[model samples]
Target: MGKLAQLSGPVGLLLTAALTGTVGFLPQPAAAQSLLQQEGTLAPMQDTYSFEGEADQTLTITLTSSEFDPVLSLLDPDGEEIARNDDYASVLDSTIIITLPETGSYTVVATSFSGEGGSYAVEVHPTTEYEQVFDRAVQLFNSEDYTDSVEAFTAAIALDDSQPSVYLGRANAYLGAAYLALGENFAGPQSLEPEVRDAIATDYEQAAALLKEQGKPDLAASLEEQAQIFRLVEPEPAPLRPAEPPEEPANSQS
Candidate 1:
């Protein structure tokens, strides 16, 4: 949501239902909407899916009856995890939310945490308005258009303020710009200036705020720790050069 938690009421309910697997009222509709593990639907001991996620995509996961160490993971074509969650509560299956960064095959793995048994539901689809903004932001970042890239990312976050990764990307961009500012001055062991230090701090702060909003306090704190460490040490001083004395006033006033 390039507008932040401003999603339509229905959309919010749909998302919550997908996340918690708590189907009620419109049982038929909910069952029809559930992509992964609808009741009675056979979920292969292992299940996988792929999608075109160039921009903003909403990938929903649902768990029916999970056991200890229940497993859920998403993989790119390169077999990299763009996002994943494997945690469980009281040996019950739990839905996890993850987003894709690029287009590729995504694998969703579900297994018992205790090496015994488990089941889950999953949904992978595009978040159009969200993806549009995300893609444009990525385009800007790759093109080295820092300001616009940041603006686009900001727009996306504003819509779904619950995403931690959005803030992470934006914060990284700000940190990159801050580091790039050193230029020729970038050489010193202590090369960073005070302004640069402050920029880094701000970047961490913004990112942490986003993570916190997403119900991830630990992650936010870790970023804060990172921001603090770099500020303590001063950058290396610039090298000094010898100076020559001024020449005698050109043969003084004739």
Candidate 2:
């Protein structure tokens, strides 16, 4: 049995739903679906977001799910795994620390290597001398506070463009802002502004191209994956609930 198998029911369901891909939930015409779910639930929760951290500092991570053993990893700007653990042994209920290189944005992937069970809380970006602007942008995105994330990301990019990763990070922030407004005003998912999505895709592509030019294939691939993050959030049918009172019909002219 996988490490997550020992987890209880409520926690297992939460983690399973978080990690599993949208495609995995629906039925397929040709093949049977795998029993495993891919994503884990965050304690508060957000699918994509950012945090701040100092350069070359150990960032702490915590796990809290009933179903899975959380493996926290920090991917460097060049897209290399600076830290990981397939053998984290015990300390299952405690915190773990990992460090990042340089002062820039890094993708912190919290995955359940075992099965479907685990919830996690991570504290990376420090509020010290070296503030985490990128992380701040992500927090804004998480809270649907788009205007600030956009401004923060823009400010970050303006300060430094030497790093291709920063461009991609800010691009995502901008996209999130646009998406937030689009979601609020529009009637359905189909109403997402195509121009905005295209802008995001294009910007992300540029970031990936820059990475490729720098000869960082791994980082480039991760950037490409990020380009698809928003592409797959399928909407579920409305849930059953008590009916609301009907609105009054307009009166006919005399």
Candidate 3:
């Protein structure tokens, strides 16, 4: 069974109730509110919500369900898709953090990843500066803009160094930047600059140490394994030699 199917908690109970038709009528779309939490059942149709946001304000939207993987989308006042997410971190829940581009009513779409029906909860609220920066860094990493992602993750760390995810994010960004520098015809680790390679290793070590301190030894061990990649040394390739001319045919051929 999938992880979502294996969920055992309040969410699982809610899903069971939904599947058994025990849940009440679906709630109406939420009105514009500074902080809102709405519960509803997705019966193959997406639930839409509205929220008022100011330009430059950071908004955090989260969708959680146990019956199916959740998908969240943010649409601007003009109905343009501003941001979307299928999963937050490695979980089935979805989250989208974005800074409002203009002051207007925004729409939030709550749906399942595979159109499966289940009970779900949606939350919309303003987030802190640190979350804003950290989320931006994650978006940059997803887009493969590693250099900028590193800068954004560093800024997030500056805002709050308590988050282990930020450190891990910066480590991945550093590693990505190193690989990007090597390009398609990469010659392995030897082709990366010492400083660049060292940065990747250092960030991973830092993240692992932080994870260990947070009692996440398993995740820390994983990070340690990832860090070892930068320490690998690829053996030098053997030089190419010119092909020798073919030997003359034997006399028997004549």
Candidate 4:
């Protein structure tokens, strides 16, 4: 018998219940997409969702299942597997992002890695203006124009709050601007302007939380450490001035 058969009856029942709980927490398509959400129980072992695609257009497909490890695969019009992903950002759920090679109908398959399927939800969204703005923000960051980069990233976030990666980029911009404003001695928080340092720490904290939620635990931990460093920076002590040379006896002579 397989491992499933070795499990105690109660343990097996608990496993089944855990999978059942995931069905209620599946995410629907974002309102920004204005598309109808697609949801269904896996047909025994697999389910396929079909949608039209356009050349050069970016597409995002997400699959979530409560009972099994979801596997997502994309197939082109000719039924060739274009790309596939098992987990998105280390999360149990699966997400696939791609730029269509040609205009045609594409197939997205939702299935389990172990062939144990259950309730699942799938959503497809096309590239929007938010993507364009995000690209621009990235360009500004690369150009080292940290101030403008922060503004551009903020704009992108306003456009799509659902995207957690944007928070990471914005946090970087904030850190960059803080250091640039210092011009020198940016290593320690003591050398930084109080307001600037505070902003940097705040952004880092926000990024850490968002990254954790996005299933990037390692990155989140790193950012949290950086934030703590700034928060713990002690004010530098004032440099002591050399005592003035003893005044000449001219005062007594006068």
- In candidate 3, the residue pairs with backbone N, CA or C atoms under 3 Å apart (3 or more residues apart, or in different chains) clash, namely none
**For each predicted model, how many residue pairs clash, with residues at least 3 apart or on different chains?**
18, 14, 0, 0
lDDT of 1 by residue, 99-205 (tens): 65666545555555445543334443333455456556655766767777778878977765544445555655554465566566665324666665666566666
Better of 1 and 3 by TM-score: 3
> What would the per-residue lDDT of candidate 2 be over residues 102-193, giving only the tens digit for each residue?
77655555556554444554333222211245446545755768678767756655654444544554565666566666666755324556
Leading candidate by TM-score: 3
Best by lDDT: 3
Q: Indicate the TM-score of model 4.
A: 0.48
What is the Cα-based lDDT of residue 191 in candidate 2?
A: 56
Question: Which regions of candidate 1 are displaced past 4 Å?
Answer: 1-122, 180-184, 187-196, 213-215, 230-254
Reference-based TM-score of each model: 0.42, 0.36, 0.60, 0.48
Q: Rank the candidates by lDDT, best first.
A: 3, 4, 1, 2
Flag regions of model 4 displaced more than 4 Å.
Answer: 1-36, 66-68, 113-116, 131-155, 161-165, 168-200, 204-254
**Candidate-wise lDDT, in order:** 0.48, 0.46, 0.68, 0.64
Better of 2 and 4 by lDDT: 4
Sliding window of 10 residues with minimal summed lDDT for model 1 = 22-31
Candidate ordering by TM-score (highest first): 3, 4, 1, 2
lDDT of 4 by residue, 75-104 (tens): 899999999988543247776667889998
Worst 10 residues of 2 by lDDT: 21-30
